[model samples]
Target: MGIIDFFVNLLKDPRGFIAGWIVALGPIWVYTPLFLIVFVETGLVFFPFLPGDSLLFAAGVFSADGGGLNLWATLIVFYLAAVLGNTSNYWIARLFGSRIIDSGKVKALTPERMAKLDHFFERYGGLTIVITRFMPFFRTFAPFIAGTGHMNFAKFTFFNVIGGVTWVSLFVLVGYFFGGVPFVQEHFEVIVLGIVAVSVAPAFIGVIKAAMNGRKGKGGE
Candidate 1:
């Protein structure tokens, strides 16, 4: 398939994508692309749309018994990718976040989204890093915002690790334990979409709330 078609397939059905890679790249090398996907999704502020939660769940499904991937290895690769990804994003923002924000180059970081993140930071403090780990777009942006706001590096690291470990472990283990069910096997695509919806729901809700609050503030003024 062409590159665009390949990614379209990957986004549409991550399980099939992982299965294809497992066969094509063998059990060992498949982890490379998986690593890169998770890394880029979390690391690059511009690429938040990449599938992170579904990808991990799909990887977990493959890592199950007789599924051709080593459970431990899959976990380790994802853990490292997630942690290192956030660290790089953090530093990138620390050094250049202001310029990036001012340039209006990243369409992903909309004013509504930024307001939501600011609310998260103000309410959760360092724990915002951990909380946003389960959130898709926010996960990618939280570290960058933290860096731009001059949050303590040590605090960010602590929460980043916690969030990474918790987020990866929860989704992967859920798939590992339940992905083999007959219903899941038959309706894997639907299930993947469900995962995406559930994962994105919180961020969606937060954005709506932020918009409403913005309107209320304007009314008050």
Candidate 2:
């Protein structure tokens, strides 16, 4: 329960957590936690719900404050985490996608979602990785689906690198530049929430579309 509360706080106020950690543990230790969170969020399917965008934004805010954390180091770490996380997910799907799907043990890899992901890959090809980088659940699932679909590794790598860097840069820079504005700083949590909402909105739309298609199929039956 305490662990659960900690993560909830993290999602709700990443800035608070990062700030506190920097104060208590000093700057050097903050990177490891950030790295782990980003890696888990992007690498593991079950952890897509973790606060990737917000965390990066908060880290950027901290970096902007000049609180011992080097901005370049933070960006480099984030970029590596994002890329490696997706790489891990891709290899996992490539190796065990069928077995995992058949076993039904993992809730995130449901047949319906996998089918939709496959369709998304078919429609978008390697570009799905790039596009989904800004999307919530899809960002985590894209690499996995591409692996299962046997997308050319070279093509996947190209788009993955671009998406990873762009996604991190956009959120982090926004925080670094505008996060200190009194309005934003005062309503920091609100802004973070808004960022998160915008990030996941596309996935919600896709879910709505899928539901409509499902209903249409039933009606036709």
| Candidate number of the best lDDT | 1
Where is model 2 more than 4 Å wrong at Cα?
none
lDDT by residue for model 1 (61-159), tens:
998999989899999999999999999999999999999999999999998788778888888899999998888899999999998974889999999
TM-score of each: 0.95, 0.93
* C-alpha lDDT of residue 211 in model 2: 92
Candidate 2 local lDDT, 1-221, one digit each (tens): 58678778899999888877778877677788989999988898767778898999988887786645678888999999999999998888899877866787768665676777787787887878988889887788888888787587888899999999999999888878887789988998999999889888877887889899999999999
Which 10-residue window of candidate 2 scores lowest in summed lDDT? 61-70
Model 2 residue 56 CA deviation in Å: 1.1
Candidates in order have lDDT scores of 0.90, 0.84
